[model samples]
Target: MKILFNKPYKSGNELKYIADSIESGKISGDGIYTKKCHDFLENKFGYNKALLTTSCTDALEMAAILIDVKPGDEVIMPSYTFVSTANAFVLRGAKLVFADSKKDHPGIDEEAIETLITSKTKAIVPVHYAGVACDMDKIMELAKNYDLFVIEDAAQAIDSYYLGKDGLKKPLGSIGHLAAFSFHETKNIISGEGGMLVVNDEKFLKRAEIIREKGTNRSAFFRGEIDKYGWVDVGSSFLPSDIIAAYLYAQLESLEFIQDRRKSIWNRYDNAFRGVLDSKHDITLPFIPSHATNNAHMYYLVCSSIDERKKLLAYLKSNGILAVFHYLSLHESKFFNGKHEGLNLKESDRYTNCLVRLPLFVELGEQEQDFIIKHINEFYKKK
Candidate 1:
């Protein structure tokens, strides 16, 4: 049997909700199901406001606009993150100042961010890689000291929490001034290709809705808050269809079950590989900090070198397991390499060459998991 890297899980209510949405004759954006989704996320996470968008990229774009990113403004983020993290700001003509990832984890090094700030610096984006929370307290303090906007690229961090120095646990997206989440098929929850813009700072609350409605106050108009709506700000069509929200709401109803199953799979992989491989193998397992909770987005191993990762990926593929490597250091990419300043982001490049993600999905059976575990061990034994 071929073990795929990811298989989107269904909670059996997606079609039912879709049919209900169709029967309601409001299949456009922000219908009954859409409101349900917004309410669900807002109530569960205590977000100031939550608006569904077509994709996480659109959400990030909305954030860039909310923070008033402009030409010559510099936005600081990790070089190891997905392109959407940088593209959102780049689209607004802002200069991207890429930071390095932590030596222990793929999240951005909060300590390194302060030195990257400049007179034109506008925002600090913290990406919570693999549903693992970054050190929000330090990041937030830096943003406070520098007076920079904090936009969380929380694309993989749903249901994750960060434990603050105050001895309180706060949800990941809630800490940032603004945050974006993805419901792509690979995430814990999915809407095929959907995302949400979470407004944490009430200052951007009204504008966030206006920006989402194609630079108009249509959301307020629909709610009878305004008699007429017109173009008021620079924005785009970022809203997702109600049909997508219908599917996402179904998944939201099963969020607990999904998180539980995914975490179980993640723990199994960690337990099987932790301290079992030889020191010569030079494989580093996933490490969750003491202050973060695991939401089980994906499990990855950091091999000693790019060559080892390539061989392991080939071995997994030859054995019919579709394991894969992740992002390729955006700083070194052809598109942005010329634009990036001459900063040696060693840790970011290390993750780019070495990180390999294994198959971790809710539908993965115990037998299939064991087969994957056995093959990985056997391959390393021969190494």
Candidate 2:
């Protein structure tokens, strides 16, 4: 009974679509498959414009570029997120004001964001951790009052929804001025290494295309909007190949099936662990707020302490299960510690040291999952 951390799931048409893309002789970006993908996302999600990128990191970089992030500009984000969330702005010479996570969940604290905003603050990047929504209403109000850009890091938020104060539910990516989503192998939808830049505000559409096409109006040239295209703006080669889009399209077509299974797996884990593990007073399960809809992207538990988490992770691995820990708090990381200004991010640090992710892929079988649950139970029982 050997179970790894993640296994990429394939829809029936992935290879077929990849073959189709190769046969079309335009394996480059924004080909037939690419157009199909763009259409699918825009039509389904109601995003103003969705551009496929080589990776989510590239999409975030593109968002930073679109907003004109410059030196000394401050961007606020959770210290508990992946480096890419901070690195995108850091590459643009912006100062990162690391925010703390909520005590109940790993999402950024909406209450703390207002205090972090200063005269130099330019953007607020709220990461929807584990497909759970952050307090977007508060964050959006703050963004409006302060005139700051909102970039939703929806890397794990696909198929997730956030209910607003107006009682309307909006897709996570659609609410922000700009957003980035990942289709990496580890995510629910995947294309090996692929991503999408969702431009909710239409102002960035044309420029977003130009930036994605290596600072050229190549997208316009291809669309017959212009006779020729050349260097136009500061940008990069962010667009992904049509092959990647093709594979992603196959996955998108079966999005419901993938989400259904993932949610089922997530619910099973929640039901199994909620009362059982939580009753022991040494572990805590994920907490979902009423305003957010779960996409079940991941299932992680917070142990009582760093030592307990490490020992439990070791115990699981020794039993042929590959449970894993998540990100370290970026503020406390060696690269940023000196520059972090020494703000106390207790909740972020707690998640960094204590959180452990269990395997929750689409193909993880009932028996295999049971084995994993049994091992986890055994590990805790002995302690």
lDDT of each: 0.93, 0.94
Query: What stretches of model 1 exceed 4 Å from their correct place?
Result: 278-280
Q: Write the per-residue lDDT of candidate 2 for residues 123-219, one digit (tens) a residue.
A: 9999999999998999899999999999999999998999999999998899999999999999999999999999988899999999998899998
Question: In candidate 1, what are the lDDT values of residues 259-309, reduced to their tens digit?
Answer: 999999999998889888625577888889998999999999999999998
Q: Relative to the unseen true structure, what is the C-alpha lDDT of residue 296 in candidate 2, on a scale of 0 to 100?
A: 92
What lDDT is obtained when candidate 1 is compared to the true structure? 0.93
- Give the distance in Å from residue 338's predicted Cα in candidate 2 to where it truly belongs: 0.9
Error of 1 at 79 (Å): 0.0
The alpha-carbon root-mean-square deviation between model 2 and the true structure, to one decimal in Å, is 0.8
Tell me the lDDT of model 1 at 377: 93
Candidate 1 Cα deviation (angstroms), residue 311: 0.7
TM-score of each: 0.99, 0.99
**Per-model RMSD to reference:** 0.9, 0.8
